[model samples]
Target: MADEQIEVLVVGAGQAGIAMSEHLTAAGVEHLVLERDRVAERWRSWRWDSLVANGPAWHDRFPGMEFTVDPDAFASKEQVADYLAAYAQKFDAPIRTGIEVHSVRKNDGRPGFHVETSTGTIDARYLVSATGAFQKPIIPPVVPADAGLHQIHSSGYHNPQQLPDGNVLIVGAGSSGVQIADELRRSGREVYLAVGPHDRPPRSYRGRDFCWWLGVLGKWDMAAPPVGAEHVTIAVSGAHGGHTVDFRALAADGITLLGRAEGVDGDVMRFADDLRTNIAAGDANYLSMLDEADEYIARNGLDLPEEPDARILGADPACMTDPVRELDLSAAGITSIVWATGFANDYDWLQVDAFDENGKPRHQRGVSSEPGVYFLGLPWLSRRGSSFIWGVWHDAKYLADQIAIQRSYQAYDAPALAAH
Candidate 1:
């Protein structure tokens, strides 16, 4: 590997990296972006072909780059990927694709870091890990081993037709699981979804999108729940055009709600008897979100129509009252399982001690304890929207500001070094 040195190095060419590159370019930071794959590779290959972005295209646009298409419309994965590629090109981001980073460590007693990549090694005074939050797919350790059933994570899911025909068990009630289950059910497959605590928001509330209300309520800017706090997973989808994925709606569509998957014994899967509690928790969070929005409207005194009773909007139907406690995979005719649990951060190559007990990179507002090392595109890094496509720019801009300040200091100290 050829050795070189640079002022700054940004990893990953996704939205976070590109956004950071934009600010760095404007500041003349002299940084290079190293990407393991082509720009937006995750959007292109990691996601399902039929999947669409969760939020509206208008809200998904980055700084100075607007979606020229219908703003209100949901963009498919392909569209989103193409948009990122164009954004990188438009900004002329100094990116080198197909460069897999192996490790990053502090250069002993030096003022920079040693970044080892597939192509070469580079030393950078400032290092930004914009590898994003969803770096690794998490599968439960309790998942049946050698169960003879086809198992795939939601990230690997593409279309309903791809799976073998039979009953499908979706092990998660988050947005991805709910959307995939709905699609499978609509395609004439018997779907059994394992319920989990989540937040259920209507696709459109009153006369505006739920996301717009979230922004208005300042929820996007709000910090994440305290560590280990009981946080509700936000569940919504924009597939086949945006719509709220309600538990009652799924039940009404003949999708069976199974409780949390506890374990697997032989061919039977054990589950908890907590579907009711899960549904109730989700409903409560949904109402709470709406209440927060209403409070915001009242406090702001914006002229708008009176909102309908939230009760009527969030009421649960009798059909969803029952929950399945167990599933005999063979008896139930289940042939496949899709785990939509979530993703974990993959920092195996980061040879730094700046990690929390949970193996997450340790950082405060994108700034790590390691001098000149920073992180971007992490969930709730600075605010609630910090991980989303529309939200990462905020953290990126913040890091850019910090980097610029450091650059100025380095420049100021350069003359002293020469004199010495």
Candidate 2:
């Protein structure tokens, strides 16, 4: 709130930013967090009605804090939003919501960074880009131009029952797409799941969450799941819902699985001629990820599933979602198309030159390549699964230590570095 005298400036007050801010608070460091909307507003408003976190409640805990909510009761999007708010309140973290930061640039000669926002300009020694990857929606370019084909991106999808009475084709086999497909099928709307590389699982793997296996192993840790450098998890998207309709179980329940959509011509959603191949590829990817998870478990000292939990439930090695149709636009009575495809990480609004060949900031951790700039909360920053709230806790601590070490104390104010 002071005039150009803030000690630390944090951008994007989401989970990563909050985690970083909490450390600053414990250190008695004065700082400010800028967010475009209310904290966790996107999570609160964007999720679909039937959405429930895939992982157990224990998975959502913050650093230095336990998620005391029901461990077995998976939280809906709304509940998770409230929990984040409560976490912020618990630490009395200083955040200014509804304030969008436009750009971040280094101050010419100062030992600090500069940021321009809707409110005003801020100068601080460190900047953390906690703006996550799920902020923007990605829609396929070749979708049908039919005025009748109703489609919505998963981000805006609130409730499936709100859609009309007709056959629904949920594209993409990611958690959102598959989950919506199952929900629509159960509600009696003929559902078609246009499958892609999906992460499918057994119905009930040995009475424990299949995810428990990964956690038991170190796959979710630094240097785990990634095939390249340290495994940095992009985003922990969703859990394999054991409570509701499992995607694997839905295959037997008569929900149709189709090949990837070739393109939609009017109401006739055309699919690639080779539906079986697409299904096989998707299934194979899921199996491989499982194998990688299992390999990590065996390497670690975790106890193995004695009775073979993975195979307890039968799997349809041949399961696939099929038949893309070229629908008649006006005749089909469809209004829109929901692109449950996924999200892309965008940083055009961020006025900096810190991105690498992948358009991502090159950082040792959250500390950016630039002198006084840093980033946090981008999935898989340093190791596998580091993007999740559960993972961010560890990363935030490491990054805070990085920031603290970078801030060397001096006897007097040198007009270069400010210590409070």
Candidate 3:
């Protein structure tokens, strides 16, 4: 392949990258989008066949394209992939699939960037890393390799029939864990879920979907508070037939609820005795949100239909009982262990010296410390919904504006530099 020079190079042809390319095209800037795999490959390969987006199709619209699906219907993973493919086609985005970006670094003593890819090299004046936030699956290092149990991350899970016929133990009570546990239970597999600290908002509240309230209230567009030492990872899901995934419901369905898994000692799995505390925290957050929503309704004097108290929905007598503290995986016939743990951002392939000690890039909004480098599609990049389907346009537009400004400056300064 011949070395090519472009005005801008955007990496990762996912939602964020496509958005950025669209913006750049509108700005009349020449840019190329590099993709390691096919468009929406992560959505196609990483998700289970039964997985649906956690939000309604109406709430997932991107710029220039509104969802045509039923407003309240959650789109399956396949539908989402198809939607993205159609989006790319509608925009005529200059996306090169199957070209892997191996490194992005400043061209030494040059005024541009050297972007190394599997195909060849490309020199560009600006670079944007549009890789989605969750690039790496985070499995616990404490998992013993020789534990004699079939282990898989949620990304690797497809269906229960693929697993050996036996009970299953799922660690991490986040959205993935809850949804997967529900699916496994429906498949007649005895399942045990490890509870974690999470936010449990009702799927529907006050005659509207919870996400509808969030959107109407401008919570997604609102700026987040200053970063603290620890960021809270809220776990909520819309996979339960458009209802919240409730732990009490799982317990009522004969699926055992365990405290947070502490560690594994041979076949014995120990749990933190904090199941009740975690439940209380989630309930408190849910009630707090409800209170805020009620205040908004009253302040506006809007006559929305009154709904029943949400506290009654997840009420189950068995949930309040002390959860099991330990379990023998071998003795319980638990042949498979599903780790629904969260993901990590991978920047090891990047050869730039722009990241901090924690491996996160030092950036304000999407602008990186490096002069011509930027980032997109990261969680909390600008707001709480920055990583969502509806939030990326703002960041992409901002970056495109900046790129346009730089291009104009370079054009103006070219003659001056040549004179020197």
TM-score winner: 3
* Residue-by-residue lDDT tens digits, candidate 2, 1-420: 324657778777777778888888887778888888889777777788767776767665674665555775567777777778888888899999999888776677566667778878777767777887677798888764444456678788777667766767677766677777766767777666666544354323334554565566546765534353232112223434344224456667766666667765544566665556544554554466557656665676557564344433346534333343444434534344567777787887666668888887777766777766777877668676676787787887887777677776522465765767
Please report how far candidate 1 places residue 399 from its true position, in Å.
0.3
In model 3, pairs of residues that clash are: none
Model 3, span 303-368: residue lDDT tens: 888876565655644635756787888899999989888888899777786799899988888888
TM-score of structure candidate 3: 0.94
Candidate 1, which segments miss by more than 4 Å at Cα?
226-231, 298-310, 313-320, 414-420
Counting only residues 3 or more apart in sequence or on different chains, how many pairs clash (N, Cα, C under 3 Å) in candidate 1? 0
Clashing pairs in 1: none
lDDT of each: 0.84, 0.66, 0.83
Taking all chains together, the TM-score of candidate 1 against the true structure is 0.93
Per-model TM-score, in order, reads 0.93, 0.82, 0.94
Residues 1-420 of candidate 1: C-alpha lDDT, one tens digit per residue: 239988889999999999999989988779999999999899998887778888898887786887766888988888988998898899799999999999998888768888888977888888899999788998897666588899999999988988998989999988889889998999999999988777788777666788898787777888876454334577899977798777877887888888889999888798998888888877777788777767777788877676585457434555346555667899999999999989888999988878888887878899997779999998889998886887898789999999888777777743455655
Deviating ranges (above 4 Å) for candidate 2? 144-146, 201-204, 222-248, 273-275, 278-335, 409-420
**Backbone clashes in each candidate structure, one number apiece?**
0, 28, 0
Best by lDDT: 1
